[model samples]
Target chain A: MNIILFEEKEISSTYHIQITDHRAKHIVKVLRSQVGDRVRVGVIDGGRGMAKIVAIKPKFPFSVDLDIQLETTLPEEKPVIDLVLALPRPIMLRRILSQVTSLGVGRIFLIDSQRVEKSFWQASLLQNEQYREHLLIGLEQAVATRLPEVSIYPKFKGFMDELLVKDLDDYSALIVADPAGTNTFSEALRQAGGSLRQGGRVLLCVGPEGGWVPAEVDQFSGCGFSICTIGERILKVDTAVIALHSRIMALREIL
Target chain B: MNIILFEEKEISSTYHIQITDHRAKHIVKVLRSQVGDRVRVGVIDGGRGMAKIVAIKPKFPFSVDLDIQLETTLPEEKPVIDLVLALPRPIMLRRILSQVTSLGVGRIFLIDSQRVEKSFWQASLLQNEQYREHLLIGLEQAVATRLPEVSIYPKFKGFMDELLVKDLDDYSALIVADPAGTNTFSEALRQAGGSLRQGGRVLLCVGPEGGWVPAEVDQFSGCGFSICTIGERILKVDTAVIALHSRIMALREIL
Candidate 1:
């Protein structure tokens, strides 16, 4: 972990915090930190700064509780990009969550697609505490305090009918990456760049492994989503998410 | 696998071939092909075509042998991007090999850097056949015939002094991604887009997880590499590689 994150309730009086969880073990063991050593630390979804280790007390046979003093923390800047992804396989989901969060996405929607495996919805990675673990790793790696909110959607049609379509009103652009798309992503962005509306936040949609089926593509197109291609080569969902989002971030000059 | 790849030696006659390995099992079990089913096939480092299953026989308890006819095939096109990367952890390297191969990199050089773990050079993933396995998976995913050539350099200073400097003669442009870089990747590409020279190939260098030390960055800078940044957010090595390469490909109209 690059930065240690703590919840607001965990902070003690006099700006000192005591940690007895994985975060404490990580600092004491993995970092091999000693008392009086200053390390990068951040409050969850709050501010980030350096923390001076004040005490290290053995809490269990192999774990320790750390007392640290927080100093000179600053509020985090908000993230710009948000992703609406077809829930990937559970293994891929874990990696994507950490990677995309490190890449600074503001939010993520793990919506269902026709091609998504039914069994994927039952995976434990969707659990809030479990999901939060991956995002914490991401935030620590990026040294950022803001946490990207993650929401899961298990029914494709229901999500589309109830929220996906309406959520388009909040974004400046709604893009779908499709292998069969006639226009390249850059071409689509160039056309949309001239007249972006709303909060300048782009809501990008990436499909599952086999990609969006014909009806799904048609539905997204009907919702005013610009269908675009990366190229003829087929990329795995995780790679495509980074590739597509990175290009958009580059073109927007946000990266 | 999107496409089944065959070595040149695997072709038995002008139009026929037999497969008894994992590919054959994939064709029989995963794809569930019958006598007349057509599947995409490609000759490694050669052409791509569709193969029709002519015959199938059980080779072992779980394996099968198949006779196939290649109807038509065309020569593969060349790839535009090549990479120079600091070898990541073995697990990450496996994902990167497949992802970049799927994304269509022409070549990859896994080189040493200040931040690279010395033990990484001894990883079994560096074995030729094991490495080729990952690349083959990538080519199969992308449905491409050609495999990217992977090279390893264990010594940083030696690699720079001997090969990296000399290799600069071959590429039209050499670009390195650094967070401290003055220009964004797009800005660098826009400048180079005006006058791309010799072979239209760009050699991209991406650092390790912690990134290049100042000395290493200075050496690369001295070699006429345009230092470019993706953004301020710290990206994992794999994410940065895809992000940087995708932007380059998009700007070049290759994606």
Candidate 2:
């Protein structure tokens, strides 16, 4: 973990925190931190700064006392990109969540598609808030504090219908990834006259392993989502998401 | 696997081939091909075409027979990007191999670095060409016929000295990835005047997890390598590789 993250409730009124969870274990073992040593730290959905290790109990049930110094102002969380992904297999879903969170996506919509196996929706990763661990892992990797929000939609048609009724004007462009796309990502962005730099968001839709069925593709197209390709190669869903997000972030000058 | 791959020796004089290995199993179980059905197929380091299923013995030790029709001309392997990576842990190494191959790299040089653990050099994945399986997996995913070549260097200084002796005139730009880089990737590309569109090769050097030592970074700088960053986020090595490769490919207009 690049940064040690703490929830708001963890910090005492005196700006002192005692961590005994995995974070404390990580600080003790992986970081090898000692008293008076300052480590990079951030508050969840809050500011980032450094924390001085005040005390260390290296015995069983390791604990660490930290004196926090958060930035006066919170970092603005204006993530310009969002994802509408067809739910992948559980293992892959975990990886994608962590990877994309590190890439700084604002929100994630795990929607259903024809090619997505029905069993994937039953995965424990999607139940309760089990997926939050992966998201936190991403946050820690990136050394950022903002946690991206995730929503689930088990019906493709239902999600599409909801999109029709929602306010999508905040999005400057809606892109759907497909191998058979007529235009490349840049071409599609130029054609759409996307204002990505002017505080506008882009919604990227990715398909399942076998890809979106014809009707699904048409649904996205009907919703004015530009169908685009990253290249000729058919990338795995995880690879595709990272590549697409990287390219988009590059275009936005964020990466 | 998106496309089935075969070796050159597998095809008979009559252009017929029989498979009894994992490919045959995939055909029978995963692909579920029937007699007279055609499947996309490619020859490793050769051509890509379709194969017509002639017969199938779906019993124990399942096998399949196919009549092959490959393209007469060989597809040119003109990969423009190469990687100089500090050896990562074995599990991440396997994923990187497959991921980078799918993204289309020319050559991979796994070298030693100050932060790289010494044991990574002895991984079984690097011995006897066992890493080929991961590369094949990548090629299969992309439906490509070419395989990337991999080299290993157990010594960092030795590898740097070797680079000095070898001719690197073919490379238009030599990049070294660093979080403390003075330029973003695109700015560096513009500064270097890289001839990516003219088929000039780009060599990207990535550091180990904890990053290159000052001397190592200086050595790369002395060798005319531009130190550049993908973004502010400190991504995991595997995520960084995929992200950096994706950005470079996008910049080259190849993706």
Each model's Cα RMSD = 2.7, 1.8
Model 2 chain A is weakest, by summed lDDT over 10 consecutive residues, at A189-198
B100 Cα displacement, candidate 1 (Å) = 0.9
Model 2 Cα displacement at A141 (Å)? 0.4
lDDT of 1 by residue, A205-229 (tens): 8999888998998998988888887
Candidate 1 residue lDDT tens string, B109-203 = 99999899898888998876589999999999998888898878888887787655477676767888888788666666656664553346788
- How do the residues B1-255 of candidate 2 rate in per-residue lDDT, one tens digit apiece? 888998888888898999999999999999988999999999888998999999998876989999988864474475778999999999999999998888898889999999999888889999999999999999999888788988888999888888788846768878889987887777766554547666778899999897888899899999998988756788999898888887776766631
- The candidate scoring highest on DockQ is 2
For this target, which candidate reaches the highest lDDT against the unseen true structure?
Answer: 2
Worst 10 residues of 2 chain B by lDDT: B188-197
Candidate 1 falls in which docking quality class? Answer: medium
Give the C-alpha lDDT of model 1.
0.79
Among the candidates, what TM-score does chain A have in each? 0.89, 0.95
